[model samples]
Target: MSDPRTPRPTRNEAPQWQSEDGSLILAKCEDCGEPHYYPRVICPFCSSDNLSWITCSGRGRIYSVSVFRRAEPPYALAYVTLDEGIKMMTNIVDCDLDAIRIDDPVAVVFKDRNGIPTPMFAPVQG
Candidate 1:
């Protein structure tokens, strides 16, 4: 387990995938062709030690959402399934909670979260 004082490493923390623009990165299993949300040294599905990182297309569909009405900005949390087949927990911003719907197309956007470049999603434009 990681210490609570230590911050979780983001995609930018790795030497290779330095997503300066806060793009989403997923771990791909070289052995099983499975993709996972968090960076890992081994493929969880196949138990293979070989894994590679790939930048997501920044496109996805909203699987579900939960809105927090008490938040200052009325935070809406979402489970988004990237086109790469990996699902991630992220925030839906720049729109009203009522505007979000299941399977809605979204694009990744970078936002500063407590000094970290966190990824958020917004409705895709035509």
Candidate 2:
């Protein structure tokens, strides 16, 4: 048996599938200077392979959310629009449902699930 005081290891922190380094999902188009997500081999808009990955600020707002009472008994699925103009679907953690609302500020947090780094969002502190 292991020490009870030690926190249980999660999948993402299991030393096998942890991200090599934090990287923002980014893609740049030649026709425009804006960056996009859902990484692709070529830019969807300009058909250019001049895409480059960049680090994200990891800040965003709650675009939408839904409380899952039946599926997970107090779980929430939310859409967060990143500060960089990209939106991602993630879970909201570290706060209560009553406290979450549309347009609420949030910060990115990495959760380890079976050695996979899953992105989660927490309410931003003032």
Candidate 3:
């Protein structure tokens, strides 16, 4: 189910990071040999236009997190440090909000928001 309040992604948005099927698309800089999120044409580190799109491992650890228990349905937001060395802001879902902690292992999951596949994370199941 999609949330009505969630904003729809614009077609003009550059570097579309997530595919409709829910795969994560990441941009890597061949020049600096670094990977970054919020996929951009130019590398943030080396300022090079040599970027390539690649499928990411979609695995990361929570670097920082905050749980908004006061919200109507509650939600957790965090910066996840991905295995590819990129940190992205995303929501943590499908688990107990109170159990979320920094450094917890997580994996990517997608939730449909207005027909767009939005990337989120959840605690890696054992």
Best by TM-score: 3
Clashing pairs in 3: none
Cα distance off (Å), candidate 3, residue 52:
1.2
Provide the overall lDDT of each model, using Cα atoms, as 2-decimal numbers: 0.77, 0.70, 0.81
* Model 1 worst lDDT run, 10 consecutive residues: 10-19
RMSD of 1: 4.1
- Candidates 2 and 3 compared by lDDT, better number: 3
**What tens digits encode model 2's per-residue C-alpha lDDT throughout 1-126?**
553423343432233123356433445565556566655667767787776655678789999999887764488889999999888878898899877899999988777655456667899965
lDDT for each residue of candidate 3 in 38-95, tens digit (9 for 90 to 100): 7666898999998887788889899999888899989998999998888899999999
TM-score of each: 0.82, 0.73, 0.84
Off by over 4 Å in 3: 1-16, 20-22
Candidate 2 error regions (>4 Å):
1-25
lDDT of 3 at 118: 79
Instruction: Give lDDT tens digits, candidate 1, residues 1-126.
Output: 543432356443352234686677777888898878666676779899788777779899999999999966588899999888778888899997888898999998877654556678998855
Question: In model 2, how many backbone clashes occur?
Answer: 6
TM-score, cand. 3: 0.84
RMSD in Å for candidate 3, one decimal?
2.9
Order of candidate numbers by lDDT, starting with the best: 3, 1, 2
